[model samples]
Target: MNTPAALTLEAPAEHPFAPFVRILGKGKRGARNLTREEAREAMGMLLEDKVEDTQLGAFLMLLRHKEESAEEMAGFTEAVRERLTAPAIQVDIDWPTYAGKKRHLPWYLLAAKCLAQNGVRIFMHGGGAHTAGRLYSEQLLDALAIPLCRNWQSVNEALDTGNLAFMPLQDWAPHLQSMIDLRNTLGLRSPIHSLARILNPLGARCGLQSIFHPGYQSVHREASSLLGDNSIVIKGDGGEVEINPDTLSHLYGTTAGVGWDEEWPALSARRHVKPASLQPEHLLALWRAEVEDSYPQLALLSTMALALRGLGTPREQAFEQAQRFWDNRDTSI
Candidate 1:
């Protein structure tokens, strides 16, 4: 009878991300932090889909609750940078938009456009609808007639055409996007939320990061510095990278190993009134010169100033150049 051919089987090996999950999930005293290299390996497994769904979910939640370290963030960013398929295109500024704007119309989009018009090559990346009721960059970019690049080739083509390109986060980091999409189900964000903000996929000379939470401002600064990144992290308008016209902005970051930070006071003499509702057309109107609201214009000016500084302009001169660039921007484009 051959005894049913002597059944043979092998147990599946433990998932690559399991160790990370264990380190973070072990009871308070047992749990420990992952080193930079360990963080990198874990993130690589996530990007490569080498972890089980249950393991991935648990790992993310543990990381979220434990709070990520600068070492972990830098390591995850390193993994992302390594996986980026985009050609080494020369990008002057890397604008990573992850936090959605609820109270504003993403004036930073216009800021980037203005800079691009003045000859700075801008590469913007972001995800859509991760948070409910918040306005994302993709929606605004669509309204403004900017094409969305879904892959590296398209990003290069868009960059070549307009000196600006907006890539959706899902295109380069689908796994991270999956975690972001779990916002509603998870009822809380994971560390991927912060990591996505500082990925800088194309290795641009300067990166702009927007943080909604004040505590994260320091995390971003330390992580970016560890990665040798020339970048700025701002508590932007609704955390969308638009300098708030009504509040002082605490900027934290590094440029050529020189730590950079400042409390840029608000531009308005009186607190600006929040609009009843935000519309993409409002941004269009502002750019088209059909609307002349001081608040939005000041937002554009201040945001551009930071970008210019990130690009190596002196503090005083950056604002001046930003004003000039805003004035000369061909809004008709």
Candidate 2:
């Protein structure tokens, strides 16, 4: 059934969004669920700057508690794709957004440069790390002398020639970034953070993503399902696509014409274990020297490299390719 043409024309009165406020603001339980379509409509208002700030905050909190339904996820994805501002660019390189680990940036930083060495176009997006922990993605990038791209063209150049680009939360989607800034004012993370990961319009046709938490697993899986193929996921750290040595790396994927590989594979941690030769003191130095050597990465770098290579290339080749990239690579930024 079509939505009332009128609701499509104008913003719904506060009356329509007010109940959401009441339910979300009071932290109440058992509110009637918003239909998947209504949820999408609600997000449309938010992105079009139709919803007032108060209602906006309320709606986010409400959804956080009630949890997002699959249909709602589809609606949100549609709304964000419509709102993304990243410029369209030709895809010469075989890569998409590679979000770095915000909590610990070293491994991802290394992987970015490693992949860049191979001419695999890469772009990583994230605000910072530690949440409030004061450390962010920039510190490491600064250490390596890698700078942020202000324009999509520069990013394209980086991908075409060197294969690495870093875009922060501020670009691509300011509407969502505005909500992230509220972290300081409201002292909480809304669903906006999750939305940022799913809204990879930068290369929607070939965008890649890092799935961090168990909660986000289904969220990304279902949302990507709505998008058909064109999305890939790797378990990430703190919600970004950095590696974790403690666990196996699992790659979930789908492509435009090609469907998902039924034999979803896992890269065992044992194969990518941290070297036994390095002492604790050396380990400390390893972390510090990452910025200096451009080889700054965790043991999981090998696994991530192998996973990425498996997509269009061979796992063994990707692993060797990543190692060679890491060995000769210069953070010379």
Candidate 3:
């Protein structure tokens, strides 16, 4: 009366991605960060969409809880770079703008514009507005007349004509963009937020990043060094890569595979209060000299100085050059 052995059903084998989650989620004693190679493979699976939603959620949350190490970030960034079909565009600076502005206008955009107008080819990219109550760069593209490119061809053309181009993350890496969109559902920002900052998809010579959290500056500096990328990480205004001129800021940078730190003193003698509301029109008006504001001018100058320093200019000389660039900007807008 026993069932036939041939008719017996075997259990399904474990999911291929289960091991990665288990490696991170194992009990405290057994859990450990994934090795570089393991992280690469795990991220590869995620990019390829071979991972299930449950596994993806668990993996991201586990990494978030533990916080990602430089090794993990390097591995993740490597996986992303492998998938990017970067065009032959020669970009001087890789500016990643994932964080939106809340308290002030995006003064960094004008700084980038000034840099671009002066022939410094800037490549800026960001994830669209995922968090609420903030004004993202993507939202102000039309107002500023900056081209929003969705493909490498458009990016190439834009850079060729204007020296500055902004590409949204969804256009270049849809998988990672999808993960970023999960911020609301997950109730926290995932490692992808940090990973996207260092992608430097076009292999630009310099990468600029800003982090809101305190300890992440070192994490970004070390990770960029591990990847052999020349990068500058700062705790800028509202977490975007724009320096707050009213307060002192620290710059954590890596060059030629070595890490260095410098403290940039405040540009203003007194602190300025945050604006009650943001206005996009003011960016162009300020650039056109239709309105005079000391805070925004200093903000632009300081931000451009940091970028010039990234491009191998001396600190004092960079500030001088930034001033010249601002004064000579083409204000025909």
Candidate 4:
């Protein structure tokens, strides 16, 4: 919390979003052409806490109903960039981050760790506590003994050592993390969630964005198209950046002139069927067994491995990398 800074949000002069907001508040359901600049003004309002809760709720509902545009996503992302603090170390090591999606236990952790252990730096971010319901990314990371770091400096240290880096959302970006509480108060997901995913500053050398849903997949791709270079967008498990189904994962990256298809041929392999078990211990033991056979823990591991390799090998090879790491497991990171 930045001490509730003085309200500074104001729509730009001659902005055309007024009509969109009015039409949306009235329950009209057509496309509202809010230019990228106009949306920036809205983000300004949100950042400044100038937007009223009533209008905020309506804005979220309308955006959800009308869906988001690539331009809007880009604009909001720009606003988020203005809000985010830079990562500590600037390295060419690009790691995929899985934020804002459902995660399975040991499965997701195993996958992230697979690439992480091999020097590809893994970064995962999320909010909302497990006190609400079942498993969360935080809990899974905890079970694996991954330390939840407190600052950007700690993240660099973790990455430098070829270990997974986990951080609670609030420590790095309180301006944005503070909004997670709003989801509880408003019972709606605001644009902050979307912007947070794409605007992360990790892997400063090569920024990567993971697309989970059919809708946001395109959103991430289009956003990258505008970013010029050093950005990646890929569709994977439940919005994770990791491949889940062992099917072809469409990766879009022309940064440094390296195409996404560069990794396509390498992804071919059998889909690792998601193992089922109620007991946590039972599920983890099963995961370890899969590791013994050199199989991937789940979709996340395979996806993270391949994304890190970017055509290093087929999905099986990537799975093997994950398996090797797990087998030689350093329970301490």
In the predicted model 2, the residue pairs found to clash are 130-133
Best by TM-score: 3
* Model 3 ranges off by over 4 Å: 1-9
Best by lDDT: 3
lDDT of 4 by residue, 1-333 (tens): 568769888876743334547745554566564678877777767777776666666777677677788788777767766767765564443443335333444355655665566666666566645225345566566566566778878877776776567777677667567665676677666656666666656634555566665756666667655654355667655554555555666666645434454344323366454546323453455445533422334454565555555434455675677657656654443
- Alpha-carbon runs more than 4 Å astray in model 1: 1-16
**Candidate 4: global Cα-lDDT?**
0.59
Model 1: how far residue 106 lies from native, Å? 1.1
Q: What is the C-alpha lDDT of each candidate?
A: 0.85, 0.57, 0.92, 0.59
lDDT of 3: 0.92
Across 1-333, the per-residue lDDT of candidate 3 in tens digits comes to 987578667999999999999999999999999988889899999999999999999999999999998989999999988888876789999999998999999999999999999999899999999999999999988877788999999999999999999999999999999999999999999989988998899988899999889998999899899999999999989889999998889989999769998899998999888777888888989999999998899998999999999999988999999999999889975
Looking at candidate 2, the ten consecutive residues that score lowest on lDDT are 92-101
lDDT tens readout by residue for model 1, 1-333: 556676688999886567888898889899998999999999998888888888888988888888899899999989888886667788999988888888767888898888888888999988787787998888777777676988888888888888899988888888889988887788898888888888888888988898888697898899888988898999888877788978888889788645778788888889988888987888889899997998889998999998988888876899999999888878794
The digit string of per-residue lDDT tens for model 2 on 165-258 reads 7776666666777877676666667667666666665653445556555655655666667766465566665455554554655656556523
Ranking by TM-score: 3, 1, 2, 4
